[model samples]
Target: MILFFGTRPGKPETKKLFHSICPYCQQQGALTAFTVKNYFHIFWIKLFKISSHTTIECSHCKRGFYDNEFTEEMKNELSK
Candidate 1:
């Protein structure tokens, strides 16, 4: 899934604001690692797609959010 902000270009401030409100930004622990898996009829393979992923740690709440549903939703909205 891919999530994108619906804002005009050349507006860094707006982009920053949008990111701040993003669900992924609300997560903590910083995505230390990411894994991807592919299943086939005979076998399955699990590999590390990215060693490190962009992450945001909450300073006050100390919470973690690694949900990708937000991005999927954004993609769906854009398709419509």
Candidate 2:
């Protein structure tokens, strides 16, 4: 499916977006959180942040996915 961003042109939008489905349960959802790591001279620190978008958890398996991973294809048909 084609996705649009702002009402006008030259706006930021997503492209070539798609969702990742769970192989075991066939459930689809967005990414809710991610992990980040900071490296120092001799040590490394890890941090996790929750995403702004709502996360979808599988009812059966209780697995969660984040929205950031999903991609959308921006269409310029409106400008035509």
Candidate 3:
């Protein structure tokens, strides 16, 4: 019999971290806390969480910012 195992993306969770200006959309109160979690899968079902990350989102223009795009101040803001 053949076995199936691989990686899968879990349902992302988002929280209202705070309101801030979005650089992309240049809009007010467009910033939010976004999270992505990846997991190992077995038979196409997620088994366990393998990795996770947090990011910033702009609701106005519907843009996202990854870890690499975060500045030092941005990092600090998330920590709080």
Native-to-model Cα distance after best TM-score fit, residue 5 in candidate 3, in Å: 0.9
Clashing pairs in 2: 17-71, 17-72, 18-71, 30-65, 30-66, 30-67, 31-65, 31-66, 31-67, 32-66
TM-score, prediction 1: 0.22
- Each candidate structure's TM-score, on Cα atoms with residue i matched to residue i, is 0.22, 0.26, 0.63
lDDT values for all models: 0.30, 0.33, 0.76
lDDT of 2 by residue, 8-71 (tens): 1121332221244544476454222232322222122223322222333444576654555332
Return the top candidate by TM-score. Answer: 3
Return whichever of 1 and 2 wins on lDDT: 2
Q: Which digits, one per residue and each the tens of the lDDT, describe model 1 over residues 1-80? A: 65332312121111111223334445332222222222222122322222222222333454433534335433333234
| CA lDDT, candidate 3, residue 35 | 79
TM-score for candidate 2: 0.26
lDDT ranking, best first: 3, 2, 1
TM-score of 3: 0.63
Provide the lowest-lDDT 10-residue window in model 1: 9-18
What would the per-residue lDDT of candidate 3 be over residues 11-69, giving only the tens digit for each residue?
88876645455667777666787778999988898889999988898777888888898
lDDT of 2: 0.33
Q: Show the colliding residue pairs in model 1.
A: 27-65
